[model samples]
Target: MAKLYFRYGLGKSAQLCQVAYNYFEQRNMEIAVINAKDNETIRSRIVVDGKNVLVREPNFDLKPGVSLYEKIYLRDSDVGLKCILVDNAEYLKEEQAEDLFYISKMLDIPVIAYGNRLIDEKKTSLGVCRLMALADDIEKIDMSMPSKRATLDFNYGAMNCSKTAQLLTKDQSLIDEGFKTCIIKPKLDRDELYIASRIGLRKKADIILDLDDNIYGQAEYLYRDRINHILVDEAQFLTPRQIEQLRRIVNDYNMPISCYGLKSDFLSNLFPGSQRLLEISDNIYKMNTVCSCGCGANFNVRKDRFDNYVTEGEQVCIDQGDNYDSECALCFMEHVMKIDTASRKRVRKK
Candidate 1:
């Protein structure tokens, strides 16, 4: 069956794609690599017959009222004309993705697209989500490995130094200097590196934290090592097309994949990526967190600049000091009612 394989991982999706590449190469199949402008790792590693191949991004600017397909076809006639391999699959827009999907079906050429399942904060798959839904078969590569823990020491204020020093057998130094140094050893648990920052898209930190490395690594590993399992963390940030690419990865490749992430944003609204995952995921599971009230916290609440409840705002806010609270729907409603009541009272006093 014509399948779209989604090998997902926190940093392993590209590895899976690499394995797939190896599988096809062993059979001497011709491949085409495509990706967005931002993907550098996969772009660097693309080789044909043990020789590096340069995959250029096609430039197609559609004029007003022009069709996207026409623009794509104009730029690269080979899209549907021949068997092609695509890397950096997330860059394709929805309509473009649809065109590619139909092209694969009509031409009887296997178009393997490898890319991340999620963007940073959007759940919408860049390219793979749509492909997964439409593909004849699906596969998921899950790599949810256990994390390690360690302890590290930090400096604390003077008052607790003597008591804290007692915990340590050796007296490194005890001068009773004006400044007191307390050692604080905190247990550090292993967490996935959130490459993308939760800042504005245009911010430098956010750009630097892009997930291109994770995607490329997973694809490379999969193509080279024949690994199948894939896992994606913080998947709520994926774009729609990226989610489609993930779906295609599973449906077409027959790889079982697991994705871990928040289901909604700080506002309790579904991110595009999370929404897509909910729609297309074969198995759904919820990782639980609790509210201060000890109730199951399924919703997120945001606060305004003045630390007041903010019911409406932009989809995402990056400024620190903006308070966020996780609550259940019931508690969220109560807070909303309270805010409303407070507003009414203020108006009456005025």
Candidate 2:
């Protein structure tokens, strides 16, 4: 039997698994990628390494201790799958992980599981740590590195991003134009200006201040019938789901929503919230800035107190001494990543 492996990562675990699946398939290995979610609403196809990777909804009964991939393998006279993958395995209960382990032993096929360290607290045994305890081998992946950074900031202006100051100015202008604008910021963003929000991250933002952070709980502070526009600051700290919720509010309330945030993190990875904004925002605008290399830049980098580049750590450290700046993709790849300039692909302006 192929060994069972648990793959855990920060921020990019899902993408990591997808990349692995693609690699295996390219090598002429048969693989069954299963979606563990009971609803599995996300079936969108993704283009990876220039090839199509479809998100397949699992056809098996996905409940704990009930996985039976062997039957499906036998019934289909197709390429024999050497391995099976459980994407979003954190959603599975402990018993479900057990089931997969048992199935792997019985079928003599590897079962690879992927999940992030973050977990929904409401769950019973779906915690990622629990599943890790049951795996034959464990692999943890994180692109973040410790800072040799002089300053750690999410300065988009340096990266050709629309400036936060510009966003605020626009909001003030709209407010002056007789628009009822509500401005809010995520607690994660450490701007000189601050706003209070819920203890945890929220998807929706149309509410007033309250001890509780939900719309209904904060109803005393908001006039649902009176809001004319919504402006969000430090929006990069929000969850992707929250970005969609803001969109729904914009339509349902018949108001416009403007969000300003870093499109990607210091590691040049997309923030979940910013990515959602890119996907569904009505209008996307860039406040461009110039890089030190004299090219227009749009990527952020992290440096340590000693001014050395730091490449290890989590994607976010809300208040660290590290420094951040923007650079062109080419320069960042060359200077920070040490990629050969000749091998670097020219990054075109958006």
Candidate 3:
């Protein structure tokens, strides 16, 4: 049966987005998202805590005294509105809260309202109070509690940190634990459809993601085939949109994902993929590696086959007669950059 649910907390908008993603993913149905802030501002997208969600303004007027229930009821037949999600519902008046109640109860459309629970430390929001009284289900959206939601973890470090090896081992462990797993890697990293580490560890990837592929769509198909976990190798090549799609996949399907990659390029600039993963991942882990000088490595140094430093080139170059070494900051600056600077000075002098 369709019901009204009120989920209230400090930051509950993400949960609303999750519901919207799931409804569309599972049933191929789109739900209406209503921003109840009564600002008359039309927006194509809403930004919630640095994340973007596509949205459209409701068809009917949302003036201060208008009845939302009547507007939704009148348009239900023409628009086929089966579900409704309310954002910033704390701004809703008591009458509007009742309107949502009637929309859910009489019209038989499910309504989920997300809002802050309190106006202050001691008082509850008026709209939240009315919904709390009228809604069929109420949930406190607490992030501190233990949850079964899928985790997005980033395992990153300099080159040859055993990142891919750990990825292979984790995939095997998950399979041994009876969790069905799928491995994927960016096609930009290699031509083959498999990931191989220097330690002789290799695994065939189920998907080789191209630059423009929709990761969520691909994952939906894999989810239908009973794949529960996803492991990504060389994730540094992933685009920002792809990382957002991975975030959506986990929220909607509760599918765990682990990404292994270098945190930065040879120039010490963060790779776009690694930066995005660091921004949004649930957990961050640094895989440690040692430099040849016996210090902990934190940077990548590029060198030609002749053992001379390749200071500047394309950001990504593979199998191009160049080698990459992990080095500590001091050694990299003193051994590579210092010598390269001297060579440049001599060339300019000539």
User: Please, what are the lDDT tens digits per residue for candidate 2 over residues 1-350?
Assistant: 34567765553334535554575656766666666667363243456887645454453446454434444345223655667777677677665665555444444467777664344522323434444433445555544674332211122233334455665666668879987767666655543344432342223333322212333222224446475656776677777666656666655544566777777677656676665564455444555776897866656788888898877667787546788888865566566656555531121111
Per-candidate clashes, comma-separated: 89, 26, 0
lDDT of 3 by residue, 1-350 (tens): 36678876545666666666677667777567777776333332458787566444443456776667767766675566768888777778888887776676456689998776555433445676566545555555656876777899888878889998999999999999999999989988754777888989888888888999999987769889899889999998999789989989888988889999987777655677876775567766778888897977767889899988877778898757888988865456556546242232122111
- Model 2 off-target regions past 4 Å? 1-162, 191-225, 342-350
Report the alpha-carbon TM-score of model 2 versus the true structure.
Answer: 0.47
Highest TM-score, which number?
3
Clash pairs of candidate 3?
none
Q: What value of lDDT does candidate 3 attain over all alpha carbons?
A: 0.74
lDDT of 2: 0.55
Please identify model 1 stretches exceeding 4 Å from their true place: 1-221, 304-306, 337-350
**Could you tell me which 10 consecutive residues in candidate 2 have the lowest summed lDDT?**
148-157
Q: What is candidate 1's CA lDDT for residue 130?
A: 56
lDDT of 1 by residue, 1-350 (tens): 12233333333334535544564456554444444434334433546899655333322332334443343443334443233444445555665555554444333345555555555535555455554433333333444653332111111111111222232222123213222222111111122222222331111111111333233323443535543444443455556456566566555555445555555565445567666775566554444456677755555677767868777777666566777666653455457424232232122111
Model 3 misplaced stretches (Cα beyond 4 Å) = 1-146, 336-350
RMSD of 2: 15.7
How should the candidates be ordered by TM-score, best one leading? 3, 2, 1
